[model samples]
Target: MGKYEKKLKEMVFRLGYFTRNWRQIVHLALATEHFGVNNRTYSPDFSLFGKRGPGKFLGIPERIRMMRARAFMGFIPLKDAVRLFPGYAARHGYLKGEENSGD
Candidate 1:
């Protein structure tokens, strides 16, 4: 891989997290006290296509697969999302506990 890709992966490794199974997902769903809501995880692999997709020359399914890879699910607290993304969750109105979030 190129140096930039290596560094990007490292940064993601440092800041990103993924849950291994449904139990954890459920825990995140039922355990959060903020608005009695389920917080979800943010996966980079799932968002690979958010900014741009593989060149249009590629087949549509391939592009879809690139976007729908099996690497983007887990539960991140909305609070963590606010911290990780910095104002994005609030602006997007995902903050069910806005008053509790102190944002």
Candidate 2:
């Protein structure tokens, strides 16, 4: 409805066309002010900031699935995944140096 919301919607749409890398998502979220920083923790409102309808609507799950598929198919290297999605990778125990161990 507002300028930032419109921008975020557009970004999410664009992201759906691409790889949906977490790094990109986080960056966009932060850039569009959809992400809030709280004592080293990030709060992202994916519902509003994520892709809309037609298929895998909420985007984040679909993006994660895509990432997993890419990793499984060797399209993405583990190190790259770690680099691109450190928070997700660490939370899922796919990488070391996780800030929060619990999911």
TM-score of 2: 0.32
Stretches of model 1 off by over 4 angstroms after superposition: 1-74, 95-103
lDDT of 1 by residue, 24-67 (tens): 33323333223212223433233222222434334445543332
Q: Count the backbone clashes (under 3 Å) in each candidate.
A: 2, 0
lDDT tens readout by residue for model 2, 20-64: 445444533333233422212255654343333543344556565
Write down the RMSD of all candidates, one decimal each. Answer: 15.5, 16.3
lDDT of 2: 0.49
- Name the weakest run of 10 consecutive residues (lDDT summed) in model 2: 32-41
**What TM-score, to 2 decimals, does candidate 1 have?**
0.22
